[model samples]
Target: MKSYIISENRDSFLGMKLAGIQGIYVRDTADIEKAFKGALKNPEIGIIYLTEKAYLKIEDLVLESKRKNLFPLITVIPDRYGYERQQGVITQYIKESVGL
Candidate 1:
C-alpha cells in the first residue's frame, strides 16, 4: 500500500517527495492521464495524491476511477498556494461519507 503523488509543479513535487511520497510532475492533460494510468496498473500503489491544480484538469477521470476501483484511493490535496475557497474533493467525500 504505497502512496504516490501527481504534482503540477516542481515545488509541490519536491515537497511531497521530501515527505517520502514518490511523485511525477505533470504540466498538461496528457501527462496527467499517463501518470494516472501508470499508477492504476501498478498493484503496489494503493494511494494517489494529486495537487488541486492537477486534479482539476482530470476531475472526471479521477471520479470515474474512484467509483470503479477499490484500490489506489485517489485524493486531491492543496499545493503551496493552499486550497481554494470552494469545496475540495476530499472534503466532499468526507461530507458525503459522514452524511454531513
Candidate 2:
C-alpha cells in the first residue's frame, strides 16, 4: 500500500508529500475510505500518517488493520492545531498494540 494522508486541510498533505511520503490528499471523512482503500491495495505503503480526526471518524478501518497482518502500518497524525491529549491517535494505537 502507498503511504497516504487523510487530512481535512491541504497543508499537511503538501508537507507529507514534500517529505517524501507519496501522500494522497483526502478532503473529508467520506474521501478517507476510498483513499485509504486504494492505499492499502498498493505494496509501497509502509506507513500511513492520517489526521487524528480522520482516523477517529474511521476507527474501524484502523482497528481492522491491527486485527489483520498487513505491511503498511497505519499511523495517525495531529492537525495543524497541534497534538491534543485525546487525539494523539497514532501514539495511542502504537502504545496499545505494543503495551508500551
Candidate 3:
C-alpha cells in the first residue's frame, strides 16, 4: 500500500518524490483525468494525492470516486501557492457530511 502523488507542477511532484511517494505530473484537464483514473485502478496504490489546481478541474470525478469506492483514498494537496479553498474547508465538509 503506497501513496501516489499526481501533481500539476514540477515542484510539487519533486517535493512528494523526496517523501518517497511515486506519481505523475499532468498538464491539462484531460491529463488530470487520465492520471487520476490510472491511480484508482492501481492496486498497489492505497492513497492518491492530487495538487489543488489539478483537483479543482476533476472534482466531480473525485467526489464520484469517493462515493463509489473504498480503496485508494483521494486527497487534495496545496502546492507552493498554498490552499485554494476558504479556511475551515474541512470543518465545512464535516458539517455537511454530518448534516449539521
Q: Which predicted model would earn the best lDDT?
A: 3
Candidate 2 yields a Cα-based lDDT of 0.71
**lDDT of every model, 2 decimals:** 0.84, 0.71, 0.86
**What residue runs in model 1 are displaced by over 4 Å at the alpha carbon?**
85-91, 95-100
- lDDT tens per residue, model 3, 1-100: 9999998988999999998999998889999999999999989999999898998899889878877887877877789888878799788556533435
Clashes of each: 0, 3, 0
Is 2 or 3 the stronger prediction by TM-score? 3
Which number leads on TM-score?
A: 3
lDDT of 1 by residue, 1-100 (tens): 8999999978989999999999799899999989998999999998999888888888788887877777778887889888764656577867533434
lDDT-based ranking: 3, 1, 2
Candidate 1 vs candidate 2, TM-score winner: 1
Give the least accurate 10-residue stretch of model 3, judged by summed lDDT: 91-100
The local lDDT score (0 to 100) that residue 1 gets in candidate 3 is 97
Residue 70, model 1: Cα distance from true site in angstroms: 1.1
Q: How do these models rank on TM-score, best leading?
A: 3, 1, 2
Candidate 1 CA-lDDT value:
0.84
